[model samples]
Target: MLSPKLEVVITPNRIAVRNVGSGATATADAPFSCSHLLADDIDILEHAAQGAMKQVVGGGFLPSYPIVEVSTGGRPLHQVERKVIRDALANAGASKVHFAPSVTDVDEQADARAAYIAAAKRRR
Candidate 1:
């Protein structure tokens, strides 16, 4: 049996936030499924996680790569996977920049949301 590791993942959406009332540093994590899953180190599946000191406004677990099945038989899917991946990203409050069909280049996409927030904090 050949189990083709099917999955979708990106960079963790880390946005440190301070508790509204307690002023506590809380790190909000996305769902475990959203994290990277790799059958092989050399060839790893896409995944993402976010770290924060406080609860983020609206960022939360948005299911991506809904399922990873082991496929022994193989035909192929050319572009549809991209659409599913795009939808996942959108659900997570991320921009669909890398979800394009033509971008065949297999690179990871991550929003440095934490850095942006940090920068804004500095400016303030």
Candidate 2:
């Protein structure tokens, strides 16, 4: 079976996660400002990722490797910032990761995902 796709949106104060296939969604609030690139405390970002993953998974089973797409509220990320986000997702059991440009509407996320998948297929 194919692994599920997970989408995560990170902002300064919150992290929202959605399992695309299952439609299970969860959100985690940061104790302080926790933007992926600007935060002084990376641990808090990691913790928020963990907390959101736990909430989405709940008592249900989660695949060992899920395709994850993370959006940093439309801001571009530096190499270090990307690494920080990747590490957090890795801790949440993500194997494949994609970075999305900031999206405003919830519907835009689905469109972005479709475009990404199409581009990835062309690359292969």
Which candidate gets the maximum lDDT versus the true structure? 2
Summarize candidate 1's per-residue lDDT along 1-124 as a digit string, tens digits: 1211122223233222333333344333343222332111111112321233102222354222122211111212224344443443334333332432323432332247567788999998
lDDT of 2 by residue, 55-96 (tens): 665544355467888886775555666777777678666778
Compute the lDDT for candidate 2: 0.71
**How many clashes would you count in candidate 1?**
7
The stretch of ten residues in a row with the least summed lDDT in candidate 1 is 37-46
* Segments in model 2 whose C-alpha atoms lie over 4 Å from true places: 32-36, 60-63, 101-124
What TM-score would every model get versus the actual structure?
Answer: 0.23, 0.66
Clashes of each: 7, 1
Q: Stretches of candidate 1 above 4 Å error? A: 1-77, 99-124
How high is the lDDT of residue 76 in model 2? 57
For each candidate, C-alpha RMSD in Å?
19.8, 10.2
What is the TM-score (0 to 1) of candidate 2? Answer: 0.66
